[model samples]
Target chain A: MRVCVLNGFDSEEMTVAQERKLEQELEVLNQKGDTVDYFKLRDRKIAYCLGCWDCWLKTPGECRIKDEQEDILKSFVKTDHLVFVSNVRLGFVTATLKKTMDRLIPNFLPYIRVYQNEFHHYPRYEKTPILHTRLIVDHTVERDEIDLIEDYFKRVALNFGSDLKSFKIIDGKGEEDYEFADM
Target chain B: MLICNGSPRGEMSNSATIAKWFLKDQDKVILLMKGPKHQEYLDILAAYDHIVFIYPLYVDAMPGIVKAFFERVAIADGLMAGKKVSFIIHSGFPESVHLEVLERYHRILSKKLGFVLADTIVIPGSEGFRLMPPKQNRKKQQDVMKLMDQFRIDQPFDDHLVRRLAGKRQSNKMRNFIFSLLEKTGITNLYWNSNLKRNNAYNKRFDKPYTEL
Candidate 1:
């Protein structure tokens, strides 16, 4: 499987122990012969989407701004499964990840299509990736926050004509408790 | 009070037009939320007792610029407790359901920041105001004017007005059929097509740059 992992954690937020656990998770995927493309978003320069609609109409499936985001968008469409790893801040994903999400609109055409009884932008690519969200937190997150995050990602997946395959939360207390389940 | 324009286009955004109309005769500073001046804006926001956020929905939620602001707010040493916050979210899509999750997230955000969620007013099909002439969006403009009247008196957004502004939530079969037809006939995408034509990229409107490898 061609799996792409987008890590939205900053240096201070990623503890040494947490890094080791993440390596273990990546190793598991690597051992299974899955080709993984990991992108640390904090290190990359991704500009905010200017709401220019150039990607849809002017350039057509291409963002005009020259940045590192083009590579991420390229990897995103080619990947079979997409994983978003971010530490929760302000009850949701980090700003780096949110910026990445905002820039993803270029991957879809501007034309509106009726899907699931609502309007959504048409996909620019034929294959939509299976999505997974993994959140890292220091303490227990509220159940409502978890559900709301999952639900929002579900909507994100829906917009891409895909489904959220799993929602995971890695609790970083005493012992590493992996509370991830396939949906 | 403070009005923050979270649109990436800064002052030229459709949200700016709405904010101006909403402000009318009110004496409030409309701060444009550019990326560099986060600390300055945070300090200004801390001083205000009430804040209004006006922005178009980007990718089904707050724009990256606005999300960045929220992250700053989470750690900033500001007394947000008892402060009132309101949101004026508009989007190109014609369905109110697209903004529901964002509305819920705003509630969570208010709780986390210890602020009062005054109200969330969503305006779907807001692209018409930007794409068409002023006369075409007169009704929407009038509705916003009425909403402004309520905002001045410190009263919560009237439920009936909120519902009317929200427009349609779910699409029935007949509505879907009509929209599909409009899409097929290029009527729904007239604005996009016109812009593409102006830019001489109409022929490549459906070009897919990121094909699956």
Candidate 2:
């Protein structure tokens, strides 16, 4: 299975030990015979969605902008599993992860459909992947904020047509939890 | 009043058109677009009579930049403690119910900053607002004026129009099939195709640029 790991933590806040642990976790995944592509979003160039429906109507399955998003979109569509690893920034997902999500309109058709008794956009691809999030939260993270994060991801899962398997909260010592995730 | 337009499309945005009506009083409201430049105005946000946030919903959430702005405001907590706030949220979805949780987020946000959430205007089907007929647009503008007039008297916005503005939560499968038929008949995509043709990018419309396929 193909997996995409998005580390939405910025440079200063991400500790070197945590980074290494993250790498170790990915190594374990690789050793288990998985194809994992990890991206540190802080070093990548991603633009905010302009609310232009070019990707929807004019261009059916792609964005016109010449950015790194095409690669991201391809990975998102091809993968069976997509993992979002983020540190809470001011009670929500880091801006990097949000930016990444904002640019995913290309994956959805402009046409609306009734899914699960709610109106949702039609999916461009044939199948939906399983979604999971590993949120690294600190003491400053409010309980309400975590709830908001869970709610936001649920909405994302709905939009992507993915089953949200789990949303695990981690500090520095919760690497063992990754073992239990569908990984 | 301080109006912050948080649409990523910047100044020339659907949010801007909605804002034009709300800022009808020329001398009172100052419109600011969300960008790095607005960070400098943090010092002045507290002094405004009220702050109006106009934004488009992106994937059931605020645009990333607007999310960033919210984080900054939270970091600078109490900067607008005594001020009141209002929200005008629009989206491409046909139903306004998609925006409910986001409204809850803002209300909680208001409480965090000690600001009052005076009113909220949630608009769905905003994609067609730009192409709306003049008479219909006039009526919508008038509806906006009624809400603004109430706010002018320092009263909150609790009008019957809220339900009307929300549109339908869902349509029957037959209507969905009809919409699908419209999509295939090219009626729904005429506007999009024309723009694509104008840009000389029509042939490339279905280009899968990055895929191995």
Report the number of the highest-DockQ candidate: 1
lDDT of 2 by residue, B7-62 (tens): 87766777877777757554233334345555776776766867788888888888
lDDT (0 to 1) per candidate: 0.81, 0.74
Give the alpha carbon lDDT tens digit for every residue of B49-156 in model 1: 778888888887889888898887777745577788888899888889989999898898888989988888899987746546777777777777677667656787
Q: What does candidate 1's lDDT look like per residue over A36-141, in tens digits?
A: 7888898898888888888887898899998999888899989888888888778877788889989988889888899988899899888889999887777646
Question: Residue B192, candidate 1: how far off, in angstroms?
Answer: 1.6
Assess the local accuracy of residue A34 in candidate 1 as a C-alpha lDDT between 0 and 100.
77
Q: Which candidate is the best by TM-score?
A: 1
Per-prediction DockQ comes to: 0.76, 0.49
How close is chain B to the truth by TM-score, in each candidate? 0.90, 0.88
Q: Report the Cα RMSD per candidate.
A: 2.3, 2.9
Off by over 4 Å in 2: A14-20, A57-60, A172-176, B27-34, B172-174, B180-186, B200-204
Pairs that collide in candidate 1 are: none
